[model samples]
Target: MNMPPTATDAIKDNLGEAGSHLKQAASAAGEAIKGAGSAAGDELRLGKANLKAELADSALAGIAAAENMGDAAREQMDVLMDKSRDVLDSASELIRERPLTAFGIAFAAGWLIAKVARSSNK
Candidate 1:
């Protein structure tokens, strides 16, 4: 003989199905949250690496600029030294060519310097 389900029995079955659905929904939501956290962590690590690379590149560029400036300064100093040497060499040649005139000019310059120094002291 077939018997019909009672009201209490029907409600029990419906409650069981509802509980199972709720568990599955909770699990799915938890998995979604975990995946989002992992993705956010990955993005942070990638951003950190990119920032380090850019800073290193900028530091290297600054070093290269300083080195270039140093090279230019050295070149300028070399030019200045070369000009000074040329002037001194020309003066030496002129002094050698006219030794008597050179001696007279030196004596006059020394006398003038002595006079100026004495006046300043007074």
Candidate 2:
């Protein structure tokens, strides 16, 4: 004849199985959380590195553009100065060749313009 299990024995067996299941679930949850944290940390590091590179590139580009603008402004000033020198030299030559004539002509034109302007105001 075989004996059947007692009520206390059955209860103990059920409690042991429930405890094992709980332990497995907790271990799985811990592993999942660890994996997720590592992934997030890696992504954050990569993003920061990319941002740094982009900022560096932008700063370099701005510096290059500023340098180019400076060069262009300097070139334009040189051209303007050369043209002004040419014009002044030409004027000097004209004055040397016809000093008295140039002065008389300038004085007469100025007097005539002044008189015309005064009459117009009236």
Candidate 3:
């Protein structure tokens, strides 16, 4: 037959039960921490991907704007070149129609330039 339980035995049994409950609580807490860390890592990766996508889109938009600006500048240069050609053609036609007048104008311009140069030197 079993002997009645002693005071020491009762205390030992209570301590063992308390230790098991503590272990269970610690395990649960560890699992929760792991899950939280995994979720945080996933969020960080998604954020990085989104940031990269936005940067790419902005870069593409900037490139498109530069191309459009280049095209517009090219068109303006073409117009300016056409106007210059027209002015040159008109001047040539005028000179051909009035050779003596052109020669007299050139002589006057040369004389005026010489006078201006002499005055500047003085």
Candidate 4:
């Protein structure tokens, strides 16, 4: 004879199925959380590496700019020094050609400087 399931037995079976589903859902949720945490860590590491690379590139660019400026300044100083030497050479040649005039110019310049100094003190 075939017997039908009782109400209590049916309820117990349904409860068992629901409990199994719940456990599977919880396990899936835990795995999803772990995956999300690992992905976030990977992204953080990648971002940090990118930032460091950018900083290094900027530093290299700054160094190149500074070197260019230094080179330009040195070239300008060299030009100024050459001009000063030329002027000094010309002055020396003029002085040698006209020693008497040079002496008179020196004496007048000294006298003027003394007069200016005395006026300023008063």
By TM-score, the candidates rank as 4, 3, 2, 1
**Where does candidate 4 stray beyond 4 Å?**
1-3, 74-122
CA RMSD per model (angstroms): 7.0, 7.1, 6.5, 6.0
Q: Per-residue lDDT tens digits of candidate 2, residues 20-80?
A: 9999999999999999999999999999999999999999999999989989999999999
Tell how far residue 64 is off in model 3, in angstroms.
Answer: 1.5
Candidate 1 — worst ten consecutive residues by lDDT sum?
A: 1-10
Separately for all candidates shown, the number of backbone clashes (residues 3 or more apart, or on different chains) is 0, 0, 0, 0
TM-score of each: 0.53, 0.54, 0.54, 0.56
Question: How much is 95 displaced in model 3, in angstroms?
Answer: 22
Model 3 residue runs over 4 Å out of place are 71-122
Judge candidate 1 at residue 10 and give its lDDT: 100
lDDT of 4 at 66: 92
Candidate 2 wrongly placed segments (more than 4 Å)? 72-122
Per-residue lDDT tens digits of candidate 1, residues 10-121?
Answer: 9999999999999999999999999999999999999999999999999999999998998999999999999999999998998999999989999999999999999999
89: Cα error in model 2, Å: 17
| Pairs with backbone N, CA or C atoms under 3 Å apart (clashes), candidate 1 | none
Task: Compose the digit string of candidate 4's lDDT tens values, residues 1-122.
Answer: 87899999999999999999999999999999999999999999999999999999999999999989989999999999999999999989999999999999999999999999999999
